[model samples]
Target: MTLILALDFGGTKLAAAVTQLGSREWLRYERRLSPIDGNATTDLAIMRSLIYSLLQDATPDAIGVSFGGPVDFTTGTVRLSHHVPGWENLPLKDLLEKEFAISAIVDNDANVAALGEHRFGAGEGYDSLFYITISTGVGGGWIINGQPWRGNAGMAGEIGHIVVNPAGPVCLCGKQGCVERLASGPYMAQDAKEYLFKPANQLQGQQLRSLVNDNLDLITGQIISQAATQGDELAIKILQSGAWALGVGIGNVANLINPQRFILGGSVTKAGEIWWNTVQKTARETALPEIDFEIVSAALGDDAPLWGAVALAESALISK
Candidate 1:
């Protein structure tokens, strides 16, 4: 049985799996969380261990990798990681090929996940789709004509930086009211924390305060969702704004690309009925009547990117 090796270098975690060329399931799998202070070196070491544990004595026909940040797809070099340092201009593809003596393909997490969905998940029957992840940050990837469309410089599908509210809060990308600034988990928590600190907004998040036991800093996107379900006004409002931002971004994307579907994944997408309803309603209102599309949750969830790595490896084997 020919084997394919898949590796995922998520900013917060790493995973490696071995699978047969035509199989839908893994033959062996290993995963580990990245250390809080890890750099490129430590992350690589952890991934290597997982690979060894999963590989045993068998050799993979091809390898595919998914990284969490920007990458030079043509050369398989990682530009940098927003969450971890020491990844600047790392020639990941070359190193992997040298280590394993086989062909390897690497791409950013968003793009890989999009490919995974198109190949095996919600986007299977769709020729054109956009995949969005809304957890620690908001990002997107496009699959057009059953092919991953990584724009020139592989910087396409950056829906997170779409400025939905130009006068609103500043994003890490140094833009005001970028979708990520309002819709990401960390940003939502930060917004809640900052609001509760003020005297006037004190009564607003009473349930949120109770959920975090008065530790405003303890507020997270999940916590906000829980509080919203329990009827926390502050949580609802913050979540609504986030959902609105994402909705506006999606609306614009629908108009521009007119993709068949939008598949949303990641932790923040689980923010209960309030968030989903807001997104759906606002997107409907924002888009022009002439444009139509559907938005759905990703079927592969957190594993989409890893599965996409499998697809990438499969493609390499097929081409060879």
Candidate 2:
């Protein structure tokens, strides 16, 4: 069957899938995540294996890859990721096409995810929308007129790097007080660890941990959510604090572009109303009330970026 080969290169995981052009049920592929300290070479090798394994029989025509960091669209070079090491300006598209002997397209992961969500998920039917992913780090994507907008230099929609506080914690981008350093999942855990500091337990040392015995290893974003669910005061306060920062970011974006809808995604969105409630309150206080807009969680889960990869391939093919 005619299909698209898609890949999502994320900080924590990599996923590849074969999907029909216009349907969700046609999705199928193998997925894997990077082990701690996994480098660029390891990720590329894993991707190559995944493509071969999933498309052994499908014989897809083109390959699409959505990378999790700044990508040069003209040259398809990845400009490093905060979580992944050794990914500085790597020529991913050329390498992929050379290896697989198929046309390949690559772009920013969040931009691709925005396309996917707009076309098939929460942002569907909206002509103008913004997508923000609050995970280990914040990432953003913009969709205008039913397509992704990769601005000149292909660094558009990097909302996470927007400065929220001049004196806040430093971001991986080497800047202090960027939105990501304030509102991302890791940032939330960091705040929790600082506020609820116990000499015996410290969570920031580990990436993600369970919440038990004040082991610090158990105080992950997930554990924080669970605690918040159970009305844990510390957990609720941390999320609320992050939400205020996010609301400022979102409001800032809203006041600037005022898109039709602002869609929220990433692991943090699983907090449901906990995050959104604060976002709404803060955005209203900070943004222009007259600007009509709606906030919603992205419908696509982990699959958002994969569909976006397909969109990248499709866009490239059509443009060609």
Candidate 3:
């Protein structure tokens, strides 16, 4: 049996799996959360442990890696990770090939997830689709004409950095009102914490404050969502603003590419009906009536990247 190994180096987690080529199920799988203070070395070590545990003594025909950062697909070199340090200019593909003495392929997680969706998940029957993840950070990937579309320098599908509210707060990328600045989970949590810090806002976020037990630092996107569900005006406002930002980005992307579907994944996507409704409503309002498209949840959830890694491995084997 032809064996394939897949790895996902997510911003907050690491996963490794082994499967047979052409099989839809994994033979062995393992996942672990990334350390809060982890860097590239720590993350790599964790991944190596998972890989060894999954492989046992078997060898795979090809290995595929999905990295949560910008990568030069042709060279498999990671440019950098916005959420993790020490990944700059790393030749990940070459390192993997040398360590395992086998062919390995790597790409940006978003791009690989898009391919996974196209081949095995929500985008399976669709030739053109866009996949967006809205958890620790926001990112996008494109499937155009039934194939992954990484534009020049493999930097395409960066919907997160798209300017949605040019007057909004600054982002880590030094841009104001970028989609990720407003819509990402961490940013939402940050915004909530900042708002609750003011005495003037004290009367507004009662439920939000209660959720975090008056500890502003304890606020998170999930906490905000919980508060919103409990009728906290401040939390509702913040969540809706994020949804609106993502909606604007999605609408603009739809107009630009006119994809058949938009597949959304990640933890933030589970923020309940309020978030989902706002996203759908805002997207519809932003897009022209002439445009027609559908927005749907990703079928593979957090496993999308790993499955995409499998697809990458399959491609590598075919190439050889």
By lDDT, is 1 or 2 better? 1
Writing each residue's lDDT as its tens digit, candidate 2 over 1-320 gives: 55789999999999999987666754677889787889999988898888888877667767888898889988888888767898998999999888767788998888989998987899989999999898887888999887788888888888888887888888877898888887788778777777656656553333223346646645777777777877777777778878888888888889999899988889988875786899888987878978888888889888889888887777766776
- The residue-by-residue lDDT of candidate 1 on 137-188, one tens digit each, is 9999999998999999999999999999989998999999999999999999
Q: What TM-scores do the predictions have? A: 0.99, 0.92, 0.98
lDDT of candidate 3? 0.93
TM-score of 3: 0.98
Model 3, residue 91: displacement in angstroms?
0.8
Estimate the overall C-alpha local distance difference test score of candidate 2: 0.82
After the best TM-score superposition of candidate 3, give how far the Cα of residue 243 lies from its true spot, in angstroms.
0.4
Write the residue-wise lDDT of candidate 3 on 1-320 in tens digits.
99999999988889999999999999999999999999999999999999999999998899999999999999999999987999999999999999999999999999999999888999999999999999988999999998899999999999999999989999989999999999988899999888888888778799988887888999989999999999999899999999999999999998889999999998999898999999999998888889999999999999999999999999999989
Off by over 4 Å in 3: none
Candidate numbers, best TM-score first, in rank order: 1, 3, 2
